[model samples]
Target: MPAVNRRLVTDYDLQDAMERQIGIRVFEHDHIVHSGGAILRFDDRTVVIQAGVSDLSYFNRADCEFFELKKR
Candidate 1:
């Protein structure tokens, strides 16, 4: 069988932040959490989630895996 894809309002916020130049906090899988400044860039296939000062991680959005924005 093939896979299905979907996007949520939160996902839109993520893309919007990337486009509008707004920094946001991200809660990812494996109990990983990143701050607003941690987001580096976004592309068609993945989002660059950073950690510490220079450590960055790539996350694929197609998995339909959900993440939350930390409360301001």
Candidate 2:
């Protein structure tokens, strides 16, 4: 009789060390603007972020709605 070896595929938890890094910053205030179809009154024309979708039509720019950040 011979022994058999088996490998597991769906029982692994991958983690990265860089993903758990955080740093502190000194700032009095900050502001950000995006083109995600939002409105604001006290942001000095800074628009709010809504969502992110994938359709292969991204403008590939920093001021586009594709990379907008939203609050959870």
Candidate 3:
């Protein structure tokens, strides 16, 4: 049987990553992907990310296969 319920990150982890100003890589498709300085915000269907120093990028949550947030 396959797992039904899976969580990528908790609320606390999100907050901590933001506070620490860490980097994250969001994997969308097998060949299409993007990464950035850190995650600004995320919702049920989308994520707002910081691409450059003062620029933000938006990605669809449904498109992501996985995401990685830096430890520190």
Give the candidate number with the greatest TM-score: 3
For model 1, residues 1-72, the per-residue Cα lDDT tens digits are 553322223556666655654444444464444444534676566777655577776767553243434324
Clashes of each: 0, 0, 0
Candidate 2: give the clashing pairs.
none
Q: On residues 1-72, what C-alpha lDDT tens digit does candidate 3 reach at each position?
A: 442322246556556666676666667667537665677887777777786878887877677643454333
Segments in model 2 whose C-alpha atoms lie over 4 Å from true places? 12-72
Q: How big is the positional error of residue 7 in model 2, measured in Å on the Cα after superposition?
A: 0.8
Rank by TM-score (best first) = 3, 1, 2
Runs with alpha carbons beyond 4 Å of true place in candidate 1: 1-12, 16-37, 64-66
1-72: candidate 2 lDDT, tens digit per residue: 553322111112101111221111111123322223211111222222223333112221233221212223
Give the lDDT ranking, best first.
Answer: 3, 1, 2
